[model samples]
Target chain A: MIERDVIVKGDAGVHARPAMMLVKEAMKYPCQVMLIKDDVEADCKSIMSVLGLAIVSGSRLIIRADGEGDAQAVNSIVSMIEHNFKPHEESAEKN
Target chain B: MANNRVQLKDFLGDTGIIDLQIRLVAGSTGITREIHVGDINRPGLTLAGFYDFFAYDRIQIFGLGETAYLHQLSEPEKKEVLEKFFSYDVLCCIFTHNEEPDSLFMEYADAKGVPIFITKKDTTKFTSSLVYLLNEAFAPSVTLHGTFVDVYGIGVLLMGKSGVGKSECALELVERGHRFIADDVVILKRIDESILMGSGAPMLKHHMEIRGLGIINVKDIFGIRSVRDRKRVELVVILEEWEQGKEYDRLGLEDQTHAILDIDVPSIMVPVRPGRNIPIIVETAALNQRLKKQGIFTARELDRNIRESLKRENKEE
Candidate 1:
């Protein structure tokens, strides 16, 4: 299992669009991913569960993943938030 | 499960389920204070200065008896008792039977940040309702992604991966005259040690999202009889894609259970395929669950009869 804490830095926080992105990213890995905000833990793969956490700017979030490639899965998601959920770098490089 | 303390504001303003018929009389600033326990304390003994084992944490109920006693006390005595009463950090105070608290008590409560409320309901009626509502509010709850329906008077929760036809199955069941409780997100609350009640999220109740049809309101499309606000979760039906080689339960001899919030709920898995009619199967599962509840096991009874007949035939031979 791997865990990393990241603060939501995006000005809009994690609304529906960001929550969808988070779920999309978490579903790519086979590992079980969870987002812990306050004391509530939400399944990262489920959009409803992630949105229900009501994450806001400056909110502390702990991304925890278990199973194969758990470390890379956690880091990928942590970096997404740390970068303010920017578009994929490859797509940005295309422009 | 963790107990969620009921906020004083929610308790006072809630008019739907448990109506305490209470109105704020004093200490408006303290309305935000939380009521930790569901039980109420009469505080008759504490008023007489016997403060030993005083349950100061609960909401103090000043009934007719306590109100009359306070009215009879002299100025200095009343002041002394009121001071001691407010010193313990009482959650709140309620005067039942439309009784009013004296100025001294109100002053003490307001200064101490302890809210004071008065109810037209008598002591017995008001306390009973308050305790019941508080316990329900404090009950532990969890949310899941599924559709809950009442088929043949049994609560059937349909769960599966998104787009696996849970919502479609529930819609078909509703069309067949079953009641739809919730779709998409189901909020389940443990009412007691044995019973788990399931309801729809407040915002998403009576709504269904089909794969191609988008979102549709079940209640608006169907009549009121087709929708229920809540029901006890009696059975769980898990719908998954049909795997060619995976062994399925053919005999119904083994009891399968899924745990939610540490409680085991009876569950069954139903594979989905193009030719299979999932709604009818779910409806049958619900009826079977009802029979089991009534102490009738059809599969076991049939197996027992067959075994007895085979043994008798062997003996005769």
Candidate 2:
């Protein structure tokens, strides 16, 4: 398994929108993905489980992925988090 | 560090006791007197009374009833109690109760350099929990000759002399879908009365240095699920080099156990030889241990089968 420490940078943190985006990205791979904070472990694909963590901005978390496609899954999730989950920041601002 | 000694002045007010000597106050004016409360002759005395009799290193005050009752004693009675409290070899006092102690008691405690703490739990609940915690915290532990490995779906601790293939066996176990808990130096912590947990040191976490392969990161190479932070040690597998003259237990008849922190854990000794499948044997050993825990003993069953066969031969004769 590959594990990396990630800090939430999105303005809304891991709220409903970001959580849904994360879950959708997690579902693309066939590996077991988990986000851990302190002693609590949450499945990355479960929206309820991720939301229950109340992961706010500046909170640090450990992202772990196991099985096939683990590397791709870790890289994709980290990229999404780093990019602030903003696919069309320019277009949204104009609207 | 010597100054760290909790003085009564910290707990009680500065002028709670005039002379500051440990002496019981008796009579109307609180005449100071020295009394031994631990003695049977002086029964019904408070915790302070018992401390006077026995020079205990520490005093654990289990607050059963009202804490205010302690202050209800007359001035002389209170002085007598304080004298016992100061004279005893008490290091610290723990009070268990949701209620607060009397202000005068606090003053005396601070003046006498006694350390006092209050917990929200009741006396009975506090005593039970404290005893449990202390037993585990103070249990004896020792470093053993072993390499703990995460076998296929099991935690197998490999033990043997230096160069007895312990590390080699662990390397193979990791390649076979099992994770690695700790290699070489495994630090064990006593979690509870009956449990001992094992974890790798910070420098060695997720990094295993094999003799032939050098250093390798298990997490980076295998992935996250292939490594664990800690694991509850379940079985101890000792690997001994094969000796021609030595007798080996081929039938697992005798029961073996390894004692760790006063708890007996199931143990197995496997003979190592050229071309032998050590990893597979170790995996079987783990599975066998799990089955044994479920009350199914394979060794005992084999022994029973042999006995039945012997009985049949005798009847035929």
Candidate 3:
């Protein structure tokens, strides 16, 4: 299992669109991922649970992942939040 | 999480479903005000000039007692009390017993953009109904990838991987005189600590996707008898692809449960193969679960009988 904390940088926080992006990003990896805010953990792959967290700007979130590629899953999710939920250049170019 | 708040307009719009029987009397523009709590307050003390521990965030209900108290106050006193009452941001105010608020209260409500509503129902009845409505709206809910069905009056939630035949099994169950609640995306709401209500997404209700047959409406094809809007999830059946050498349960001796939203529901694992009649198996599971609910454990009873007979034979020997 791997755990990392990342603060939301977007002014609007993690709203519906960002929540969807986070779920999409989490679906890329095979590991089970969870987003924890204020001790309440939500399944990262489930959009409803992620949205229910209601993460706000400047809120510290703990990204916990378990199973294969756990570290990569945590790293990618942290980077996604750090970048304000923008698509990565490499992936943007591929698209 | 902030989006968990239900707007005042939402409750008004859902009057048909919940039978609230409420109508806007003042502050129509404030209909969009959000309701943060599922509870309500009488505000009788607030009207009596007692503001300590005032629950202003909750929906305020003015029963006959409060309304009569307001009616007895002089004009100046009423204005003074109303000003102080509206000073704090009250989500909304409701008048039960079909009582109408005076012009001063309506003016204050309009000025503050606090929606005011009146219902013909009495205080206790209306309060209970509104609380029930708000509780349901604010309940913790999660969307799961599964199919929900009612088999022999038991709610059986079918879950597994994407291609694990959960939908097909539910479809067969529906054909066999059962009721289908949801398909693919099941929205589960924790009604209380122990009860979980399962329903389908608004747009995808009663619709199922078979491997090759495409999307079909279960309600339309199977008729109304085979469809239900929601049901209490009493059992969960997980269907998985049959592995080459996996050992399946031969006797139902041990009880199993699957947790959803922190509530543990009785669950069973069924391995699916081409020849297995999954629908009949699910039906039998539902019946067996009903039996368990009635405290009739068939397997345990048989084991107990065998032990008793063995004891008698050893004593005779």
Candidate 4:
């Protein structure tokens, strides 16, 4: 299993929307993904299981992905959470 | 695409349809026909032998004028026009103001497997309402992780990392007498170019799942006035865990915006800490937005005052 530490930077801590976003991002890979916050571990594939953990901002999560393409899956998930789960960057506003 | 098809069954029991007073006049068996276009066509010109620019795939709306004109036509002429009209693949026909078409027209529609819907609303009302419903139904939408609340007449959307107390802050606002729109999952729809409407997702409506506490319904626990069905999003407040030595916008001079879909919304980042009263900060932020809308900028005013005082002191020196 490939593992990486990710910090939740989303202005809003990982809640229902971010949890669903993480779950969806995890589902794109053909591997087993898990997020561990403190001692609690959550399966990234199940929306309910991930949301149940209630991991918040600044919280460090050790993501473990096993099976084929585990490295790629772990990298993408790490970026997804670190990037505040934004699908795209918001162009800075010129005041 | 305009050719994208939606079933009539999907639109039947929608909240907007209830006001439409819609009923199945004929062809209930053909309820599965695809509703191709979000736009509606009156089809009066098409009925009058003008087929060059006919949008037959659109939902056909027959008003009093169109119905009256059809009645004016001779039986054979009407039959010929309708037969030709039904020949092309169209979504369905909607008759407004409970206006019943000629019985012969119904037979043609039934035979052609065209669904017909009758509404008590007049042509103008039905057209406006239907257009709104269709646009909203097919609008590009996204579900966001945030709590929507109305603070001092301003819609404040609270967003942050998971387990960052977003819901807790929203609950605090709810207890402070502000109307709560949605907790956990906020479904946002771009109703127009500039307007975005925020509503609670159906599964977790009126509910907040706190870490220590399992689940709490704000509407039931608080009162009806404490919660709302939806609100027009005006300001976005993002809560983040406070980091030592990290620079934050203390002066609030630079305007920040968060883009969802193609629309840009005003946003502010509030760092969360043990002693910080986030709900109060959110309230003040919303109030500040209300003031901004009214052409008042407190920070700019303060800056101006500081400049004037500094200039006076320089002259004195």
Rank by lDDT (best first): 3, 1, 4, 2
TM-score of each: 0.85, 0.53, 0.78, 0.76
How do the residues A1-95 of candidate 4 rate in per-residue lDDT, one tens digit apiece? Answer: 89899778756788877887887788888888888877556668756456656677889999999998899989988888766776545412211
Candidate 3, residues B1-317, lDDT tens digits: the string is 21375788888745545878899989888888787778889999999999999999999999999999999999999999999999999889999999999999999999998999999999999888888777778888877778899999999999997668887898889888999998866888887899988887675667777767756889899999999998999999999999988988888899899999999999999999899999999999999999999999999999999999999999999
What are the lDDT figures for the candidates, one per model? 0.86, 0.65, 0.87, 0.82
- Please list the residue runs of candidate 3 whose C-alpha ends up more than 4 Å from where it truly belongs after superposition: A1-95, B1-3, B13-17
Q: Tens digits of per-residue lDDT for model 4 on B1-317?
A: 11233678777755733456788888777899766567899899999999998998888999998989998999899889988988898678999878988798789778877888888889998899888878877766776667899999888889886678888898899889999988766778887889888887565668776766766788899999999887889999999999999999989877899998778899999999998999999999998998889989898999999999999999999
The positional error of residue B35 in candidate 1, measured at the CA in angstroms, is 2.5
Task: Give the per-residue lDDT of model 3 (tens digit) for A1-95.
Answer: 99999999858988879987898888898889989887657778765557656788999999999999899999999999977787788556655
Interface RMSD values for all candidates: 3.7, 17.7, 7.5, 11.4
Q: Write down the worst ten-residue block by lDDT for model 2 chain A.
A: A45-54
Across B153-231, the per-residue lDDT of candidate 1 in tens digits comes to 9999999987788988999999999999987678888877878889876655687767667567899999899999989
Best-first order by TM-score: 1, 3, 4, 2
Off by over 4 Å in 1: A88-95, B1-3, B161-163, B183-185, B201-227, B243-247, B253-256, B262-264, B300-317
Rank the candidate models, highest DockQ first: 1, 3, 4, 2
Q: What lDDT tens digits, residue by residue, belong to model 2 across residues B214-244?
A: 5577789888877887777888888999988
